[model samples]
Target: MQASPIYIPSESMDADAYQQPMPQTANTPSLENPEDSVDDSTSRESWRDNKKPRQKALYLDNDSAPEHRLSHTLQLVEELIKEKEILEANKELIRCVALTRIIYGDGHWRLAQSYANLAHGYLTLRGLPAQAAQHAESAKEILLNGLDMSKSDEEKQAILGTLVTLYYTLGAAHLIQNNGRESLHNLQKVEKILEELQTLDGGKAVVLKISEKDLALALGRASVLQNKLNSAASYFEKVIDYVIMTEGDSTPELVTIYQEMAKAEQSRSKHDRAIEHLLQAHSIAIALYNKASVEAAEAGLLLAKAYAVSGNYDDAAEMYFAESLRAYQAALGPDESETLNTLVEYSKWLVQIGRNQEAYKLMNSTCSSHLKTSGDFSETVAEVFHLMGTICLAESKMQKAYKLLKKCLEIQTAVYGSQHKKTRQTQELLNMLQKSPTTSEGNKTR
Candidate 1:
């Protein structure tokens, strides 16, 4: 899923510069629950106020059914989450968990799902991956370890659905740590469960996000696990077709589909198609949202990368890239990992366009400074070192290049093990350095 780095708000970004929207939870308003409906007669604020009081009254009423009270509390939590009242949402979640435990014991399906919801909320909105990971594991444990197997088929299906939700959060949390393989494994488990259900039902009623229309897209996304770029792109196209059919034109939602499709194209080395999709996203965002919007800024960044990769190192491309970088920095600050990722990509562009010293300086000064905090064994740190080493090699600074490449090898070997593709590449690069008579650092040892 890696392409032009997408922003996942870090603690520094979350502090002031970036705000993440709440994720959709299964417990949220669905076709099954009409109580969460809106009335056109009332203002949004009035509706929220009216609904809260009604839910609160039901929640506190001793005569109300326990299940009904719990549902109302969850509904209120959903409202709090949507409004970005995170502290209130978390507090309410705790109450819901406690009540569920008291009523149905610790193994309650509702309790497990609530934990999964909180896990997702923390990871997506609060930029707290460690806490999110903890809750995600807990959700899985309670569901798999605590839940009884002897239950109705419907109950079992619902539980499995909650497990898929939990696995998705776990995958996101793993991605936060840059554990792509681990993230993929968790997401694959989700697809496996969905596939199993489909096999049992002769491919009927495949559980998917929001609606059955999403199942094809979800499976397409899951195809990424098999490294199937064409399959992934085809699935995203289905989603695109659905969007056009329902909305009659591209909207803000279409921007996400375009971006994902572009990512698939980029992964397949189809830079031209990637650029086209990203440009579409940029154009739509500019028209419907604004230039300063995060979506527009990100789309521009992706488009710039696509242009650079396609060897279009023109002034216009540079300006678009620089403009987008500056916008993101303003909105997300210079220290954000997302901003840093863009800076690295821009540095690579500079190198490709015959500005090696400028590229070297940007990476050596800014990227190196922040990258050190990513830990010595971090794969990201290894990649940065590899890039800097390559730049140094190009500049004929063999001694410095040898040292940097050696460090890259060390980190890559430690993190990826010697058998990994990246580790093998690092070794080959080092071997090439060793074979060079011009190699200045002959006796270097790491």
Candidate 2:
């Protein structure tokens, strides 16, 4: 469920498997006493009388001032979250929460901001998916309610930005749930709201940054849902350039963008570009020791798929299929359907590599598991059948091959229609099998 970079063992993991060291954090800024603020306020008018604007600037600056300290503090919190320093980020969030409470008393918009920051910190880190989802949902509720109570455009925009982030979190959760329609609906709302906001205020508003990143990601996701590989490629290409520009080409975020972009490219048959992006993503993942990350797994699988498609059978078999098989096995062990689908893809690669026996074994395992847990109606299972048919054909089992291939064709036509790419592919496979003679036929001819 949690995607991270794959880590190859240098020696072994037994020594460090259970020991996770906490990341370091900076100390929190101290808050001045209320009495000191009161004293300062009392002396303000006399000080203003004695000193000019430039001379009095230093004396008047207070931690409690809206522009002076709060803004800087919020920026610091944002930076910490960006760095993935969860504990320190939470510390900053709590401080902001306390400050907002002090400013707005309680149950007010300021306090809502603190909660939103805390929610963001949880969402950004790799480890806190469930908690992140909960906090994001809570922040969305508070921000929406706060919008009704506030009249200021800036305040409303800030709250709306948080709502945008919350929607993204919700969308990601729905994706995990395999609820494509719900995820698309939530993401569509975010896109619509952002479009409206851009029209009203243009870019550079507080909401704009969040909108840009989230909307681009959503478009890519929606394309995936619709199985429009080209459209997804377009969406990924749009934001990937921007991500590289802002985060540097080597940053983890940029690597993630490239990993997804590679998927789009691979789907479009851009094998060289796909392999290039995959390599970059894999490099970054390894550098970060992100071997267990989603990005790395995705990159490895995509690279393998690309190599298989490009007819580099040896590399596909040795590198791509091997790593992808390991990753898919790791992912599917906990009963993840997505991982099973990936496993099915790896099986396809195996078939391509002349590993019919291995592919058949994988399909059997996949078919058995899916039959027990869910069903055989999934696209993944359909693919497994197709691979099985190909395997049977390779082994000169014509009757079994014909049956499986025909079944696969029927399933594809039922799900995607006769004209769909996948349906057409299955049809072609079936036709080739029907026309080709087996080794047994050659023996009969002799």
Candidate 3:
């Protein structure tokens, strides 16, 4: 008989910004544990407060039977994970690890699998790469030992499935820690084992929790981190092929992949290729959502930045920047943070091209809008005041610059206190304006 499969959660494996639909499988694995009731009276927030007491109660209720306690704890782990209580789920996973060791001994593959699952939870659920790496290493040691002792083909296959997840977790954890070489090495191991499993199953891909697309994307990212641009592009191409074959060509899922490809091309100084990928992404955003939508605005912002960096497409850059600003204003309102940020970025570009007067006018109006929306004491208002002050200083308007910097200083002092770097910087600017010859002449005349 085949060993009972342990299904690792694959919900977070997609590299795209948007989630793709996963097929429902009938053979969804379940632990054969007796059902235990949990108190549902407490809200999710209150559960944290009552956690210790509830855990104590669980142990006391099943104190005589380790099996019953393990079963109950495992059920709780499932419920907490489904409820998005990741911290609590992690704690339960720790408990599961200990219980698995007690019930099945240290050399058992199930104990190793528990450790692997916990490691995955640390990386994926909590973003703790160090803890994930530590646990994953432990899982690998135990798993390799167990693999050596396995007799049946079914048992070996099942253990190998767990090994796939274990290696994938290690790769992801190392990737998060920016250890690209280690990450790529572990992911290559995953690919090799997967190939081995396919060969064992008559030269076809085995059904595993982590899909081929996920592996391709992970490998691509690891390759990019390792500065292997050609290898990265190849893996990304595989991802593109997989996505296109699985989903249609025009799906929004293509947008993130295209953006990532553009970034890789940009890193390689392939500006034309980068622009091509960005243009495709922007066109898809426009076609899938309206031009005025937030999605289109974000895509336009990226395309505009790429054009600005190319230095030969100033007019095109400005046009897209203005369009993005307008789209953000229309979709999210004039005073929303996105609209304000887009306005600021456009103004910065104008200033970069020596359109100081236009940039000043734009920022002056934004100051009023930010004051009315985010209030005078907000960081956004302070930033606008600082930018306007800087613009006035550049234009030789000493008195205006002095007043704007004074306002900026006041806001910074109020929000960030007198000793803050921004407050001190604003004060220094005001001091320079005070000592200017033009300002002295203007003050004497007044």
**Index of the highest-TM-score prediction:** 3
Q: Write the per-residue lDDT of candidate 2 for residues 164-274, one digit (tens) a residue.
A: 666766665565445667677777777765554444332243523243544566567667666778877777776676566555667666666677777777767888888
Candidate 3 lDDT tens digits, 1-446? 01123222335554521122223233311222201112323323456555656543544253546678678877777677767776677667776777788898888898887888877776666666666677888888897763673356555666777788789888887777678999999999988876656545423223455666777888888898999887888888887887787786787867887888888888898888888988989999999999899999999998998898888899999999988988998899877777777777888888899998998887667546565454647676677778878898988899878877888888899999999999998998888888999887777888
Q: Among these predicted structures, which one has the highest lDDT?
A: 3
**Candidate 1 weakest lDDT stretch, 10 residues:** 3-12
Per-residue lDDT of 367 in model 1: 57
Error of 3 at 287 (Å): 3.0
Off by over 4 Å in 1: 1-52, 61-72, 82-84, 108-111, 124-127, 146-150, 196-248, 289-301, 312-446
List the candidate numbers ranked by lDDT, top first: 3, 1, 2
Better structure of 1 and 3 per TM-score: 3
lDDT of 1: 0.66
Ranking by TM-score: 3, 1, 2
Per-residue error (Å), model 3, residue 199: 3.5
